[model samples]
Target chain A: MSGGAERRLPGHYLKSKEMYSLPGLVEYRPVARYLFSAGQAQSRFLDGLKEGKILGKRCPRCGRVYVPPRSYCEYCMAPTSEWVELPGTGEVHTAVVSYISTFRERMEKPEIVAVIKLDAPGYTKGGYEFAGLFHKLCNVEPEDVISGRAIGMRVKPRWRPPEERKGDVNDIECFEPVES
Target chain B: MRPNIHVKNKVAVVGAGLTLFRRRMLETPRELAWEAASMALESAGLTLKDIDCIVIGTAPDAFDGVHLNGEYLADGAGGVNKPTVRVYVGGGTGVFVPIAAWWHVASGLCRTVLAVAEEKMSPAHPHPQGVFAYIWDPVLERPLGPNLIWIFALEMRRYMHKCGAKKEDIALVSVKNKANALDHPAAQAAAKITVEDVLNSEVLVWPVNRLDISPVSDGAAALVLASENEARRITDSPVWVEGVGFTLDNTHWYNRELGYPRYVQYAARMAYKMAGIERPWREIDVAEPYDPFDYKELHHIEGLMLARPCEAPKLLKEGHFNRDGDLPTSPSGGLLGVGNPIAAAGVMKVAELFWQLRYEAGARQVKKPVHRGVAQAWGDLMQAGTVIVLGN
Candidate 1:
């Protein structure tokens, strides 16, 4: 944008694999460690997951429920003091099939993920604000997602055994269709 | 929100500069910043001593593999002792750099400001997407093991469904932007390709093709901002900064509708009001909407109100947004064509407008008689919108 192509760009181009063999190239790997706290609302929600219960916090002002709940409502900005145990059921608002993992490695079997719009009392269907969870979907094939049959299908969480639970969101293995 | 109507001084862009954008760079991050900073200073006909302050814009520390990046880039950005500050909003940092510099001069705090943006994505091992994996909510989303492209693909698919736009319609953006990039010296993925080339490219996710995305890049861009009095002494053709606006929406991206960017609209309205321009679709002469993805350009076009909702694709198909069309957008090949170095990409667009408004862009200049130009950047989980309007 500043100088014309005549001045040329000021960098060298290298292929992904070329860097290893290049001379004088210093390779670095990050060794930073992290200890994350799930915080109060999320800690309580994880405990509910370990017990096969889906929990949300209800905003006293807006009556809006939040999953993976927050301590306060973003809209109402009021403290959420009431804890609501949800029915652990919702329909898929949107879904996608991922063939790659976090590292860009191809998977043997694709995973279907979705934003499940969880139902709550006094909540209108398809409102802008609603309780939702981002999770993996089981018992649903990739083809089902492509054909649009997976979306809008009611689903419930399939929890891990209580003995194996670690008070984590993964305690629920994946959300599968109600029939499944 | 209306910007402060009683600003102390008007700000103008006296000069701009950029280092070539490439997928991998042999130069270190500091070196990249220095190269761009020097070019910008040289263009303004001023030495480093003339600058009163420095504003640096860069993305995450993970990309550079170095913590305290702002401090690390101090020497390169000429911020040795000057009041230096780094402003970041993910990809929005590019344009936000100048916006930060504008206030420095506008407030009479600094007579001259140097704004620089640099990103070193190549330093990250394997791929930078691993760094982006940390952007998600660790408690709820990390457990799902989602790929970065999955969210973009979901948004693309939703936009396609709601707008009734086909994959072919979206492919046109890739074709147009890449062709425009053919003239860009720093373009990493520029080519003379057809829509079939985009559709036939390797598919990463269902709706996202390899060509549909911008290449990972490492580079830097910079601009020199001066007050009205200082600018007149430097260049006779200074591009004035008319107005600036930024808005950050809620981080709960999935909680809202995916078809349109409501945050961008809010930001655009704020900017247009302060710029004293009504009916941006008819008044604004040129625009550079953020285009990290092909569809994103069209999505942002609608958000900018350059075209009506779900009307960009139709206007695009008719060549209304071309270099010679009614409204020329992204004539600099944009991030889709040039490269995406996170923060540097947005600065590149604003720099392009600087050159175009001055009629100094030899080949990349649009055909229209330009006057008012708007540049915008969207970032931070699709939650941030930053806009700057410039006129000559």
Candidate 2:
């Protein structure tokens, strides 16, 4: 049975309010580590990241190249053998402005999160899906994000310094819009 | 056409029970499960000893602050030293609990299966919001310092922008569901509120608001499932478990159109096909689409094919989703009004449908007679959908 809204304690209401407020709990635990399998194909993909280059695996059955390097093709379920380098330019599909931190507390400065649709050739089966990744949008105003102009805008990865490259997912900094 | 499924025996839900949906309960997680499970077994005219096997569903163990929580709750759920299986699919675990039991009885694996679902969000130190951090990408997404509401708000905004639904329009769902919860004995947020109340509530992230969301709750719900032979001998009006379905989409939630829930549609299709239901909007007499957030009810109603995409909000405004309306959605109130104990909240929705189909819901009964009913739940990065169909 649903709890009566009128009988709801103030704590209930307050918790709901906490989601958007600033200074929220930002540091979360426990630490999580994910292991990536660097098989013959992903090893080269990892090597490319260390050298500040984006690499993908190509499937022979469907002739598709997958970014982030997959050992097998999702669509054809065939083994991939070729490693392909990409231009790393794509368009933003959606974006949002976050005033609260990851812990549901408020933040002094709001951050903009955007989903970039990568320009991988034959990445998705019919373009309904894509080789897109979620990341922060640099050099974009919150108003631009809210106005829907941030979407469909061309963007390129802003990589970190060459010496600072760690062969990790965060090696490339936020993605920035490519000006005409 | 021959059915694509095999049913060794008929399965019926004999009893159901739930704990008070509270923002925070003093009782421990195991205690909450025991309280709800005891009540369900007592209602079924049985005891823990009569249960041949047990099936339990709890959302993420993170909320309870204990990993492998199913094992931790086994004794309290009355599964000690008995064959037990814990199933999880985000919030869908509530109905999935019974579905797990359905297979046990339907496949001749057990005669009586006790299904329990529980969630205690209060145990998480500091604030439960910290638990949501793990749901995002640790390498890429988390470094952006994103709040959990961002994803939900993004989807809600996209749904509203695409469906031509106004915030005020979706507020009616909050109003109706909350009002319906007023009659619920364990309701946490049941109230007679107006759309203005929802509109005036603090906006957390543009589209999402304080009132539009369900409270983090501590509670538990349980159900008893039995084979046809055991069901007929136990009760005259056993609610039959007709069909069940679950599906998951890729983790790339934003890659696809946010207007429609393809995962929910796929799950609903699988259930309807098994139940021999050709037209859900016309065939199903009643429904409960998961409503963790007010707009989620409308989103899931479309996902369940109860209404076409972009139609739920309008239909809601037209009184088509009220308790006395043509097709009552969430007649037992919903997560918005009921209080969301995560996994337990979903199970409560399933139990409400069981009560409605059995003609046992006294004050909270829908206006019309119900021969068949459906309950659907969505969870996990907006990617998982679970559907269950029940009939008399």
lDDT of 2 by residue, B1-392 (tens): 22768889889998887878887676678888998898788778999888999988899889987889999999989999999889998877777788788889999999999999999887676678888877875544565666788887777766776687887888888888898888887788999998888989876676677888888888999999999999998888889888888998866575566767889999999889989888899988899999988888999999999899898988988889888888999998899888888888888898888888877777778899899999988888878998999999
| Tens-digit per-residue lDDT, B17-70, candidate 1 | 888899888788889899889989999999999999999999888898888998
Residue B189 local lDDT, model 2: 93
Task: Give the CAPRI rating of model 1.
Answer: medium
Q: Best by DockQ, which number?
A: 1
TM-score of chain A of 2: 0.73
Candidate 1: regions farther than 4 A off? A1-5, A15-18, A124-126, A161-163, A178-180, B1-4
Error of 1 at B132 (Å): 1.5
Looking at model 1 chain A, which ten-residue stretch has the lowest summed lDDT?
A: A121-130
Best by lDDT: 1
After best superposition, candidate 1 residue B218: deviation in angstroms?
A: 0.9
Candidate 1: residue A178 lDDT (0-100) = 98
Worst 10 residues of 1 chain B by lDDT: B250-259
